[model samples]
Target: MRRPVESAQYTSGQYARFARDHGVRLSVGRKGQCWDNAVAESFFATIKTELLDRQSWPTKALAHKAIFEYVEGWYNTRRRHSSLGYLSPAAYEATQETATERAVA
Candidate 1:
């Protein structure tokens, strides 16, 4: 049996049609479950504190470009993550790749 949609945002005809066309599931966490979305909230809070709160953009396009650059150039590449033993994401991924290759050899 198909599950009932819990949120109106996902229940609208337009969203249903879009999801069907894209072969996507409109899934969300249970209502009042803050833990399910904690990672996303933390990421947004970091962005707000580091970028959004620091600058004023005159255009939406500029803001979009700035956010893209910030994520790609700094956050994903150079910024150290304590969760990854203080290595940047790119460095952590490289280390993982090297380990995998060594194990396979």
Candidate 2:
């Protein structure tokens, strides 16, 4: 976890490089602002609320597996998202595919 101050001080290139090194992407907002990451913050909040807050795991491994299931199997595959017209992410992706096929046809 990065401290807010440390994260704020990192240049875009440095951050991007660090992300690349870690095999993760960093969507850093513009400098001198915290509100730019509202969407990500909201997602984390949802994850905590719906998944983490609802259960207690006895071990780190169990917690990891539970979070993985929540994110991959439930949230991405089945949860309705208001931002996507109340469709799950998988459903939204399917709709996008249909739209692309219709456009091609």
What's the count of clashing pairs in each model shown? 0, 0
**TM-score on alpha carbons, each prediction:** 0.66, 0.67
Winner by TM-score? 2
Superposed model 2: Cα runs more than 4 Å off: 1-7, 10-13, 16-26, 32-36
Checking candidate 2 for backbone clashes, the offending pairs are: none
| lDDT scores of the candidates, listed in order | 0.84, 0.83
* lDDT: worst 10-residue window of model 2: 3-12
Candidate 2, residues 13-100, lDDT tens digits: the string is 6777878999986666667677767757888999989888897878999999998988899999999988899999999999999999
Task: Tell me the lDDT of model 2 at 28.
Answer: 61
Tens digit of lDDT per residue, candidate 1, span 1-105? 997665567456687789989998766555565676675787799889999999899999999999999999999899897778989889999999999999999
